[model samples]
Target: MPRSIWKGAISFGLVTIPVKLYSATEEKDIAFRQVHASDGGRIKYRRVCEIDGEEIPFPEIAKGYELADGRMVILEKEDFDNLPLATTKAVEVVQFVAEDEVDPTYFNKTYFMQADGPGTKPYVLLRDALVKTGQCALVKVALRSREALALVRPRDGLLVMHTMLWPDELRSGEFAAPPETVSVSDAEVTMAQSFIEALSGDFKPEEYTDAYREALEEVVQSKASGVAMPEQTEAPKEAEVVDLVAALRASVEAAKKRRAEGSAAATG
Candidate 1:
């Protein structure tokens, strides 16, 4: 099992479930390190003072908040510790709302809320309750040195906590003008519905593969073996101007063809 990033309790209406938070996702992208190109040496960065042009140690650094008139309010570690918000260690549930009411765009990172020792009963109860009622718990959690608003919801059979974006941070529809509705013929609407039906399939996430990762691995392997790298091919160019209605009709026909072929292959 992966190491737990945080150990905490989920609090709701006098009930607290001890849970270990584990990251739900992992980044597998190829990473490149900063290095000196000529000598192949690793590049290093230093914290230097803008005024004095001197390198400063980590211990000498203090947090600062910029003001309106180019002035800074420097703060020591003790200053933050004395703040009222810092004293709270518990994950406080503020409210429960319908899970569907929450917009997905507001969701940031996700963490698995695994039951800690003797927490299985309450954890399962909360999970079942959420599944049955279709409600999500809006909670406030202090993690990574900052207070975060989160949504605790059921995913599969486990509880997942997703950090929510602040209301002010979300863009409102008032920024853009509303779109005009266009009327479509019955024949076109029927064809579009048929296309959607043709394209429908089970959402098996495992079926998806990262072609870029595979290509990168192949390139790295070839270079490590001292083999000459193949020349990269340019992607085919698309038409600069496209007819929306024609494209939709063509896509529908393509989907229908794919579905027919799949059905035929299944029978054969």
Candidate 2:
């Protein structure tokens, strides 16, 4: 089992449920190390002081806040721990709202809450209640030296918390005005609706994959084994549509044909 990152309690009204927070997701991104192109040697960096031009050890490095006037304010670990922030390690549910009311844009990192011994009953109660009501609890939690707004919801018989981005952190998306001059005809809209209906199906996340990552993994394995890498063929580009209505009609027909072929292959 993976180790828990945080130990806290969920303050639900009069009850407090002790829980441990575990990261709900993990990144599978391919990472590369910096290396010299000619000799293939790993690159190394040293932290040097700007004023003294001397390499500084990790222990001697201190957090500094530089002022606009070229002055620096250094802070220690003790100073951070004594800061005037509510450092109480608890997830306080402030309000409950319909699950749809929470905009997905505000969501950041997600963590799974596991009941910490003695609090299992209360934790199950909250999870069941959320599942029945289909509501999410808006909460405040302190993690990583800062307080954050979070949403708690039930998922697979467990309470999951998603930290939210502050409203001010979200940028206004007013880059350009909507194209009012462009309009769609009823026939074009109907054909487009047909295309959508033909292509629509239940979303199964397992069916999709990162093809690029798989190809990169194959390349790495082949190179290690002294085998030739597989050749890749470029996909043919679609011809530009001169007529909007014609394109919509063609799309609907293509969707229907693909669906019919898929059904035939499945039955076969």
Instruction: Name the top lDDT candidate.
Output: 2
- Model 2 scores worst on lDDT over the 10 consecutive residues at 80-89
Model 2 per-residue lDDT tens digits across residues 46-163 = 9999899999999999899999998999999887767775535689999999878988999999999999998999999999999888898999988876788999999877889999
**C-alpha lDDT (0 to 100) for residue 31 of candidate 2:** 83
What TM-score does candidate 2 get on C-alpha atoms?
A: 0.91
TM-scores, all models, native as reference: 0.80, 0.91
| Native-to-model Cα distance after best TM-score fit, residue 2 in candidate 1, in Å | 2.8
lDDT of 2 at 109: 97
Writing each residue's lDDT as its tens digit, candidate 1 over 117-226 gives 98899999999998999899999987776778899999989999998878888887775765568566776677677778778989978968999999999999998999
Pairs clashing within candidate 1? none
Q: lDDT of all the models against the reference? A: 0.85, 0.89
